[model samples]
Target chain A: MNTKIENKLTPVRIIAFIFVALWLVIAMFPFIWTLWGSFKVQADFFSKADWSNAIFGFHTEKQTGGFFTMDGYYGSWIEEEFWRAVINTSIVVFFTVLISLTFGTLGGYALARSTYRYAFWILMAGLIFRAMPHMTLISGYLQPFFAWNVWGILPTTIIVLVAINQPFTLWMLHSFFLNIPKDLDESAMCDGCNRFQAFRYVIIPIMWPGVITTGLFSFLLAYNDFTVTSMLLSDENETMIPAIASFLGTVQEEGKVMYAVAAVVSATAPLFFFVLFFQRQIVSGLTAGAVKG
Target chain B: MKHSTFLLFSLPSLSVMFLFIAIPIVSVFIQSLHIEHKQVIIVTENCDPFGCETTTAVDTEASAKLKEKAPLGKFNGFKTYSNRMHFAFDEVGEAWKSSDSFTVFTKKLYNYPLYRALSFTLTYTFVVTPFVLFLGFLVAVGVNNLPKMFKGPTIFASLLPMIVTPLVGSLILFWMVDGDGVIGATLQKIFNDNSLSLKASPVLTWIMLMVYGIWHLMPFSFIVFYAGLQTVPQETIEAATIDGASKFQRIRHVVIPHLMPLAIFITLILLMDNFRVFEPIIGFRAEAHATSISWLIWNHLRESAYPLYNAAGATSMVTIFGVAILLLPVLIRTWRDFKEKNKG
Candidate 1:
């Protein structure tokens, strides 16, 4: 690794470049595949498609340009339920992040500044809670929700997402709180500001990146999840991932896989939106929480 | 006064944790001891003998059904375990069905289809998680010293995958991977017919999964790692340089300790997530072959035809046990640090 950099123009340097270049090529395959698969019609897709079914049978019966047609592929996201999933994910992401930021700030400050006896247990518990699979809550636990009511939507999904995201929120925020130099807290105290005032005015601004990244994670987790949502949400109207799979599953066996493939491609938009927006802050925030105090 | 206020701040989070996180864990243990709403171990003391003699016919029928299959009555501790073991051992030659679609063990959990679903799922997660982390870390380290003008956007691009909601991301990958999808048609136009079937290939499906997984998770590790990199004091690096420390030396001596906590955090996060991971597996199910342990468990809950719902429950607990052991150290360390930090 170091051989390439030592001379700057050595064979090793060229090899290193080639290796990285190759890595990029390998990494680009799936995205390329998704794009390629979007154009092929159903029959061509079914006959020739092997494993990566995203493009194989992507054609339709209409002979607009022979084997090509976007309608056969990209038409599903226009469906009402797809939009409902968007709204459903948005609702959970917005509120769950909101809850994490609000509570995480307070809890983090408390952990950083206060003498609490059970703080260790709380932290450990939070770690375990975060570590535990969200699916367990839906499948193994929460019998009442499955058995008793079997109806309704908002509170159930919202509450569960909120709980699932809390552990990561608490763990990450606590680190952010620890990073603030104690002198800052002392200086605020000396300036006649109480702890809350110090936290609200002095600390919160500095910790904005932490709050943002944690909130981003919470939002992403809620939006991307499938297992708990599959069990907790029986309603097709509220389904988030019911449509994204392509070229495989029993759906493939039933001949709908091609259509499903088209539908799933549209799901990539929101995540792109997040990456496009939070690029810098996410990096700074996560590295800060991970690498530093 | 200062410490107490902090406690006040922590209260809502703590309470919420107890209510949602803590309580659910307790319920898992409770459910494990005795199956819910059945007669695995009939609680005669609760109602029948106590004089609150109200019982429904449906409840009676259910209890009767439970009792008939339960060769191990209330006095029989874990008799079902032996029975299952016996069944598995006896059927070694013919473990699966006549159609040979799936095994008795696999079918017992959710129907054969769920495990069928899981085969693809496990295939994807096993392939996706490690490679994403490995490649992500390399990218983070490589771009660590670049100028912000180049570095910021470079790292930002990696974040592209993580930022997208999984639902949306999977859809995009789904379209992008198939040969007839947008990119494939263009490739075919440029290179002709030989290039189009990439999405149909199972190997290509995993490649797509790895790409999507990397795209989604790279941002997370990059951000986390970049943050950690920022904290590595210039003084330490300067000191290493003055002593003629090689880049490897700096990375090994100065950089690694500097990044240990972050690395551990991300790795642990991945481990916990890997076990319970069901989304990408389920999401990519159509084309990309995959399923995780959690998905199989879920299949049992959602799919009624699953032969052994109880066995799936038991199998899922196997995954939980793995998580509990792997994360015990992190949980312990966090507890100690949290206590120290909370001391006013």
Candidate 2:
């Protein structure tokens, strides 16, 4: 594993390396471009007369003489109350990851330990449920929630998101839990620990990697969701993505596209940081299912 | 674990699954059968005072009473499902009956909501899935061949699009494709056309959306395939090379075979995910040019006044049906695998 393959350079290798380098630039350049544009004024960023204005910010007139301006950020965060959306998003992500992980850990442990027909059937049902678009379930939620007068609140939305996230959480954690030696649980039980205690002590310590991975995914699901939140949450409870979307309609109509651009940048910033820190978990979480399947 | 312990462990998730996922499916089916209450209008004519006038007013009291009596309105069975938005049975029949030419008939197909969405959804699913897989494989092989120093950064850069929120990702692309943005402006200058814009035409918009689709999904496939490539037995490659097989021959015969299961797994996931496409259309503001089944459902739910609950339900059911159809092949494959494992 330590020895590097010292193959002679061929034209094919050069071409491949060139393609990889080009793709790397293509993949990473847009975010940098947009993030830069978000710091400039509207006219300069989306200048019709000169494309260089986007980069140079020549049209932006602000006290900061440099090519960047904070006007778009100010307009979005201060005037548009994007902070409220940020708070809402944090609440949703916090609770969604917490609750889904709690429930998923228990269910996935049980499924992983069991050698029964029920576990198989349940996993199968989960596969089917995973395939159902979230919108289909929203109509069902609407009738009962509206009838009960609990439609648009944060708790209702959280509960629904938790429910929606459960199947994947369960599937992921189930496979992860399966990877641990069954003897670990068996010996813990044989030592006078009950099943719950065994899981609490013996399994919990070993399962953190899988749990954290699943939790990260749950957080991303809650954070990046536009469909369920946009549908279920009222105006006051809108998350960042949906709020940014709402801005696209009205703000863009008002010729304030920069507000939406700034908000988009703000919304994506956390994810960029999240990836920088937890890229390992994200990659593992993604490949886990495919490899298992 | 004992039965009681097992029940205690599984109860929370199972209940949530049943309450949210299972029951909602049945409710969606039932809801699609009944129509929402439409306003009863009353018109009257007065021939006195200033002049003869006609007025149209909503019979709110009667409508309210009707709503109270049957909150879900009348049970219309499958009527809503057959309407222009869901199955478009009537429109398809009429379009066939009325069109004098193939072009006219195909143009009329766009007028039917379900077919319009189905056409785009199918095209996007089929086109984007294969391209992503192929491009992902290419990138995976290329990156795998590179020095270890370059791999991490390349992988990191690639994952940004896949990780970003779909709506935000699409909007970033939308901004770039706008008339004034870098890509659009560069494209116009290259073509020497003053009137070129990505948002201006349907075909171009579709291509842009598909391109976004590939971009957004490419990293997932690339990562998965890259991981798969690492597990390819080096001995096989060595053997193929010893036989004087070219690099292409080695990959084609050995590496690809090893990666088949993973590729199929990615394909199944990509199909299911792509079939429910909704966010990009909204983000790109491409609804005027392209619609998906999910968008059709959301459109009904967000409609002014009555909100078309029944129609939305029907559309959701239709979408669910489409997803299930897409999933059938994958399900069969999984079932066969399970059966083979049990036999072994």
Candidate 3:
């Protein structure tokens, strides 16, 4: 904690500081640029005369009689009905997180508590499953889903996402559960409680920290997913990420790229707030697997 | 835990994985062996106009019936795997025989879609992983040197790129680098070439995507390495410094060795992630220049008029094989570690 040695104004320290400053600009600039540009007309945002027009919004002033306009937001949200995609995204993310956590906790608890050889094999299988590219899995599901008449619905996508989420959820929670003392559940069982009861009463009450951390990740996976949600959901049941993508295809010919821009910013706003509120949990969740290994 | 109890506890998770993950892989393998049925054709002769005229037309109803009867189409039995869109065994052989030099042969092979995709995927994975590790370490060390007050805000700023959805993140960058956008305009002005466009060239597009990859992934490695730095033993660092080591020497010897395991962990994760790169290509609209294996399969299913399930299935099977091959060394190492732990 000594400031003199660590914070000395040496040449190396100055260079490192400049590098970090450069990285911060690179990391933060694009989002700030997009968010700013979303308010302007395409002419101003993509301003041919000068890039500074995007900053000052000269064409936006000429067109809309102001420096800022909500035309893009209105076009995307109201005209294109982006709200439906937002609602669909909420439902899918909510249920996917809930169901994945439920199944993950049970399986992870069993894996952590058991001493069988099969436990090792199961974890290994989960590792392999975790590495499977999601698009490849979606390719596998399309034919069967179409044949069964379950291809383009919210529930089917939710269930499929939960299944896809299992391997990661199990690994994370299994490691988390290993950190919890075994005696808590065992001592409860010794007091004449059965296994499920011990889990419900003894383990459940004290498992929130790990569960919350795992749940944040599950929430992120469901929220940020593009492949599964885009391919599996019907056009009518589109989520935000897919809807934003589809907007480009339809709006490009109509000269409405700003609508797509607005939608992209809208979709990212929730995740921005998510990181703001849950930075610690997100950081810990990322390092949990690495640290344990 | 008792076997029965363990089964009871894990039943819901296991059943879903079994029904969804495990079975679909099997189904994908089976579907790869079959291609869509050819359309039924009917030929007729009309004898009214001085000479008989023969006409051929597709029998839609019969083809529909065929599709209805066998939803998986005709069983072509591994033909789909060898077709021009996939592994392209025939094309590879032709290219091998005709080309006089190795480079010429590879250039010919790169024209095939699968090989083209494989080249990009492997290059992106290997190229991005190392940069992520190196730059991420620098950022971690830099952040660690800052006074405690500025650390939280800096970390918050750093997390935004990684935390945002990949497609959206790429799109944000893509727009800025578009011909009329900020960075693109600035570059054109600097280079004095109004015709210059990032999207117009293959090499530039590849670099742009890889740069985006490094930007998006660096934060994850940074956070992990930052955590690793917290546990770097102060005693070792102090001893090295006291033994006439410079600050760089102390970091190079003591700090780097302590963080080596974390670096390996990050590399494994970054490889797995970067190999499956798909969303950024779409977001950047870079498919014209670079296509990944995931994007290739997705294109097969979604871009065509009807889903090319057979082509997609074949690609998926191949991709799964690729993943297995990529993971083989790590799996073997893990297995050895497990065995050693058990023996000990």
Candidate 4:
């Protein structure tokens, strides 16, 4: 490119350039702070932990420690409980996402294809369920777990998560099926293809975006979920957030507080990567429209 | 033929959904009602009979019973309703009523703090939704119309805040806004007196919360609206310009309407998610005057010294109904007014 031509960018372009650049820094500031703070030693944290004093004035004293060390990471490593939380969160996220997606896809396809009366009502039921506050289910439904034995306890937590997530995944994919005009199916039938074949070949390919987006969202729905897990799950298996939370108890148990951040960081690792890897689609895909259900 | 095909397409999905979600919900409802004698609600023993051996084996069969029941009532319709009828926690009457110094509103109000909670969420939803939408739109439109090279980076740049977890987001806000702290001290440079805590004043707390919410949420909205803008038909905008439509008018009439469906989607998500909030309250409640239905439940559960479990359930049931009412307007619009909008 010629130098003069490159320099001849429009005023609008120049203006947007600055705005978005400034925005990216402001946007990344939190994550950057989290990353940096995760590395800092305890005395440094005591200084930075202060909201009023330390932020702009954040500094390291030379005598005490290395500027960039793994005190937080190593400190958190000592807690056996923190590792168990890792297991707990993974269990919930794995089962919750897998189950909801399986049933939700089926449910979405059914609601989309139903020509009968009350089909909309069925879909509406899902929407109302989706709109319900998580606390409602957690509060009313948690009692039943006490009714059962040991096996019922784990499966019960998974059920709460699946119930909470089903409506979201179903409604999301249902819209995708709807936006696909009905003519494709009609034409496929005229071509002598059966209902299953049309959906398998023609409809499914085009709706892949919706499926992927919905699947990713469902994965996120389960992975990012904390409140339901917090309420539903009992001890020893408290999902990641609560595990980290147990560390922050009024007592400075858990050997050190930094591991709480480490545990939080590890728990969110899959979620954070999912967001970053799927950045374009996630950002573009999650609309106010997502609240439709 | 079409019907059969549709049935084939639909049945499998419907069955799984029915099996998992629908059945569980119905089961919960049934469990909530306590008329059935078979439905055992084991009230834990005050004194372990295992420890207090030979303690009052009153009846002949009482030893075989599961820890001895207390006339555990027989199941009947509306039994759950009747059991909790006096515990509705509402003040419904023709006149305002007083319970000691606190004046409970009569004429059927939802739980008092719940009203405050709902209102608090509503105020957040209303302010944050539009503010984020408009800010996102401005950035998106401005960035999209950028030199082709800058658009991609700009879009990626704005998405960082939306991707971080709520815990981290709160921590950042915590670091910046503490009293006589970093952010406060920074403000003190301009406003004087670093001793002022953001938590000290309701106004400051609200302002900071608004800032935190918008900062975190704007990126998500910007990403979606930007895509919606791209799909916006260019010729219509060009024609509007040719007809001498000013920039403001063009956006108000042309761009905004194109983005309405997306806006509604964002609104619905915000309406649902913000109302059911969890993190912000847990983080800010120490100093801030903020508390929602979510945080209230957490506080109760956290202080589980009393195991306020039943009360939490009752509170949750009421909160769900409150949310349903809040969402009812959209429900009415989607069901009844949707076709009207299409025709118009």
Best by TM-score: 3
Cα lDDT tens digits, model 4, B1-344, are 35565455556555555654455445545444433234333344445755743333234354336334623223354433323332333343322355332344521333444455555666776787788877877788777766567666665656656655665466556654654334555576566665677777866776777777888788877877777887788899999999999877888999899888888777776677667766765555442366667666665555666434434544565566667887898889778764575467
lDDT of 4 at B254: 95
Model 4 regions more than 4 Å off: A1-22, A46-64, A150-154, A179-209, A250-255, A287-293, B1-112, B179-181, B188-194, B286-288, B337-344
lDDT at residue A199 of model 3 (Cα atoms)? 96
Where model 2 places Cα greater than 4 Å from the true spot, the runs are A1-8, A61-64, A253-255, B40-56
Candidate 2, residue B272: CA error in Å? 0.9
Candidate 2: tens digits of C-alpha lDDT, residues A209-264: 99999999999889988889998999998989989999987875543788999999
Model 3 clashing-pair count: 0
Q: Residues A49-101, candidate 3, lDDT per residue (tens digit)?
A: 79989999998999999989999999999999999999999999999999999
Worst 10 residues of 3 chain B by lDDT: B145-154
Q: In terms of TM-score, which candidate is stronger, 2 or 3?
A: 3
Which of candidates 1 and 4 is the stronger one according to DockQ?
A: 4
Candidate 2, residue A84: lDDT: 95
lDDT of 4 by residue, A1-293 (tens): 66566557777658867877777777775555556655654344445235421223244334234456565666665544566666776787778777776666656766776666466777777778777777656545544455444323457777667777777777777776777788887699789987778777887677767777776776666665667667667776676665555555632553264565555556555655676578766754575244343
CAPRI tier of model 4: acceptable
- Fraction of true A-B contacts recovered by candidate 3: 0.76
Instruction: Give the DockQ (2 decimals) of all models.
Output: 0.33, 0.74, 0.81, 0.39
lDDT score, residue A56, model 3?
93
